[model samples]
Target: MTASRISNTTGWLSFAGVVAFVVGVFNVMDGLVALFRNDYYQVTSQDILVFNFTAWGWIWLILGLAQIAIGAGLLAEQSWARTAGVAMAVLVAIGQLAFLRAFPVWSVLVIAMCVLLVYALTAHPRTRAYPEA
Candidate 1:
């Protein structure tokens, strides 16, 4: 299909793709800050709930890269993007939770976006917007 034949679900899928892509970029930035610019964060590494900032940085970096790839797939309407988006959203949400104490507002915002992405990706069945090649 064509754009005219696309259903409302197409909008949601596109939204999901964009949001995931943006979030992935943010995650990469967060990771970099955590790693190289530790002073940027409000809390010290010891104060966080999960691993140290360095470890968290690596985790976020990897997660972010994966998210970016999945988001691109979503945008391209790849058949596997939906499932990957759902899984990544869950992981990102959990990461936000662990990160809440350090940056409350930003973490919450990221979590909310992740939720939206999850909802958009899973709320309805696949639409004609994307077809496997």
Candidate 2:
């Protein structure tokens, strides 16, 4: 007999994906503002990090797209979305950590969300909800 399916909310992975989706939406808005305004500049030194505004624009756009795709896929209980979502979230986290100066609050938030996303994706219930292809 098929094992009974549990609720998607039974674990952190699902929650993480949800968080990623929300954060992604926020990033999209932030990115669009930065891209359109042309007021994106900050102090820089050998120790501080900064992203090229133009390149960052594209990065934000691509990452946002991926985040949405992964979130939607997970919500739909798609297998690939689980892994992709986790991967993208991790990247976002690392990128944030590396560039914390440019976006202190946002970077920290993304990093925190990344950790939670990893936990959620690795959680047992979430794994079961999205079986491998």
Candidate 3:
């Protein structure tokens, strides 16, 4: 890869790391709100897709923490982080969809970020060059 392309790829990866971290932080805040102030959300527990706010609160809180860890790994350029980030981003996007009714705008925004994160993680060129015959 050309030097400029390599640098651009690195930059995108770094941006993805930052995005993951920010998303995680948002999720943590959302979880806390759900846990402490259930009334903050528009929908009631019965209205949510699955479990009540309390259950979702714990779920988000745990997932957020995992995302934060993955973000750190990505920033450090760990190979596992790229794979984990893709998986986590997908999960987060799905979870956001499940959460759409509670907070429509926020869910959509997070889903968009997750999509960007996935693209950033996967769009880079392969580092290993195959032997040409």
Instruction: Sort by TM-score, best first.
Output: 3, 1, 2
The whole-model C-alpha lDDT of candidate 1 against the native structure comes to 0.89
C-alpha TM-score for every candidate: 0.86, 0.75, 0.86
lDDT of 1 by residue, 44-78 (tens): 88899989999988988999989999899888889
What is the C-alpha lDDT profile of model 3 across 31-121, one tens digit per residue? Answer: 8988999999978888888888998889889989999998998888888999999999999999999988899998899899999999988
How does residue 6 of candidate 2 score in lDDT?
Answer: 71
Clashing pairs in 2: 12-120, 13-120, 13-121
Task: Pick out the ten consecutive residues of candidate 1 with the lowest summed lDDT.
Answer: 1-10
Best by lDDT: 1
* Candidate 2 local lDDT, 1-80, one digit each (tens): 99997755554656766877886886676567557764553633333355665556667767877787787777777788
Task: Report the Cα RMSD per candidate.
Answer: 5.8, 6.5, 5.1
Backbone N/Cα/C clashes per model: 0, 3, 0
The deviation in Å at residue 118 for candidate 2 is 0.8
Q: Give residue 70's lDDT in candidate 1 (0 to 100).
A: 89
